[model samples]
Target: MKSPSLSTTAYAGASNGESSERPPFLRMRGLCKSFGHVTALSEVDLDLREGQVVALCGDNGAGKSTLVSMLSGVIEPDDGTIEVDGQPTYMTSPLRAQELGIATVYQNLALVEQRDVAANMFLGQEPVRLGVIVDRARMVDEATRVIQRLRVGLPSVRTLVGDLSGGQRQAVAVARAMLRGSRMLLMDEPTAALGVRESRRVIELIQEVRSEGQAVVVISHNMEDVFDVADRIVVFRLGRKIADEERAGLQREDLVSLLVHGCRSEEAGER
Candidate 1:
């Protein structure tokens, strides 16, 4: 793979008195979402800092996907606020979220099976030449550039996305996020169904993205993958945040229990 030329400043901490350009580029405070009588997310507060990888952990229905959906603009919260650089903002829609530089890579790896790598990355927004023609060269060049930005290991830009390995396909999906100049990325199980080596490659690529001054939020049930890449771990249970612990201060079972039952909040009133 060709190496990408980049600057160390790509992932620098915020110095303009804004919230540190550290991990977590976005934060939701007192966020709530409901459907009819049931609540999918309740008073949830989460953060996504630049250059930091946050692992969101929980059982199947712990509102993991729902919360991210709201953050990604697939859904809008009925209550609370979203803050970027400590300033409150509204996503209203996915396009608005993209304009805010927040991107989410869904679990299905939404690349068109019929499209090649370049085609997939530039799916609906292909670069146009002079007036009315597909700028194939520019499309491929930018596609290749973004792939390297994430340090993604791909066989070729011309390769069909469907033909790539599970990990490679995931890489392509992630590279698509860069096309929007995303500052924050939410990935739903990027390593799912991959062999050990392939999973490692994807994990490494994720690290590269984080190193490039971007924030990554990973939703995974795999504790091993979480430990392998996360700088901090956030556990959710029954649509509520249970714990937000740094990786060095916690263990696998501790995180697991927090996901299953929450890290026993001392707030007796909650209990």
Candidate 2:
């Protein structure tokens, strides 16, 4: 497999003022995965900088979710190397990923409808006082702090998650990830199935997260949302990365062409 060139200006710099001289926060090389007869991903290389938002754009079955699953420890790559902080690492499980400061927020949000925001935020990792009882006060206090930090406008952390709107639920999920000390968030279709106003709220939340110096990987089919939030865009096609480019100067038509035809008109001409 050919190594991805990182010397390009597109790979340099980050919104948080991180020096390009530093290694990427996360890097994958020669990544591959398969399911019996189907190749889900092949020879894929990716880099993610700290405090940046990288959008994964592709049609269905383009291998976006496969790559995300590998990163989140939901599945392992059939072959490849994953590096964190320039050191080789294996994401063995969801717990291991969390331990490594990586978190995934799926479209469902994975929230407990019956529980309140605070309870959901601290779900499995709830604090304990004296190792005997759940620390409700600490949980609520920390939840409130995270919500404020994310600037999510919810009625209260004590409000039932089921009663919250879709955007509000997304906020709860994100706050929960932050509360768990996750430094990188892998979000899948964060704005799907929401009204225009609600989707806008989620988009703003993503920007807020980026401004706070956290890396975010957003998988979305919505081009508007992608352009609105991503610092860089990576396009996948039929189990391979066809394009990885900065969002600036990339027209929606060209991006659409890449997603549908796997190449821009100029690239097709060159071919």
Candidate 3:
């Protein structure tokens, strides 16, 4: 496994008078979205900082997917603002989001099952030789570097992605995102539907990615996994933010209450 040789100065704080006290690496204010008569999101505000891992938690129909889609540029928000580095910007499409250094790894993994690991990693952006042929050697080498950098254990880059375990396939998707020069990674249940050990590996990989100084927003219903990797947790209910709290001094039951009842225990008590 080779190490990743990418510079993270762009996402890292304290560059050119940008101090820690300044705005977050990414910010969304008053974001709202609707489909026909149904409101998908309602005045949502969120912030993410570089090198931080935030968990997005909510039950079904809680607007988690809608919020992520807006951030990833799959769909634009009907109203609100997205700010990168404290500058207002528009996310017109997925390509525009990538141009802004935001990448999303959806739950499907999005790998060509028949393709080899290296091929899947560089699917759309393959290295070319002499402006004509695909450079197979360089592709494999770069894939090896990304796998090693993420510390994901795979037999070889030449191995088919279909033959890899669930965790390995997830790693490939993440590596593909990283190869695109992503400064912020948004993962949708990267650890879902795997054996205990495989799920553990994926969670570890998320932590490793955060260690590389990239902002990560993970969407998961598994409280255990969320507590394991998330520095902060945000909960959405009925298309609105219900809770945004640091992991510090937070209890498991407190989070469960927010997901199920749309309020903390004490708040429920008042009700």
Summarize candidate 1's per-residue lDDT along 74-100 as a digit string, tens digits.
888989998887788888898888889
lDDT of 2 by residue, 122-142 (tens): 888989989879999998899
Global fold similarity of model 3 (TM-score): 0.90
lDDT of each: 0.78, 0.86, 0.84
> Which segments of candidate 3 are over 4 A away from where they belong?
1-19, 269-271
Give candidate 1 regions above 4 Å deviation: 1-24, 264-271
Deviation in Å, model 3, residue 122 alpha carbon: 0.7
- The regions of model 2 sitting more than 4 angstroms off are 1-19, 269-271
lDDT of 1 at 121: 92
lDDT string, candidate 3, 111-201, tens digits: 9999999999888888999997999999999989999999888999999998998888998899889888999999998888677788877
Q: How many clashes show up per model?
A: 9, 0, 0
Cα lDDT of candidate 1 equals 0.78
* Total backbone collisions, model 3: 0
TM-score each candidate.
Answer: 0.87, 0.92, 0.90
Q: Which residue pairs overlap in candidate 2's backbone?
A: none
Better of 1 and 3 by lDDT: 3
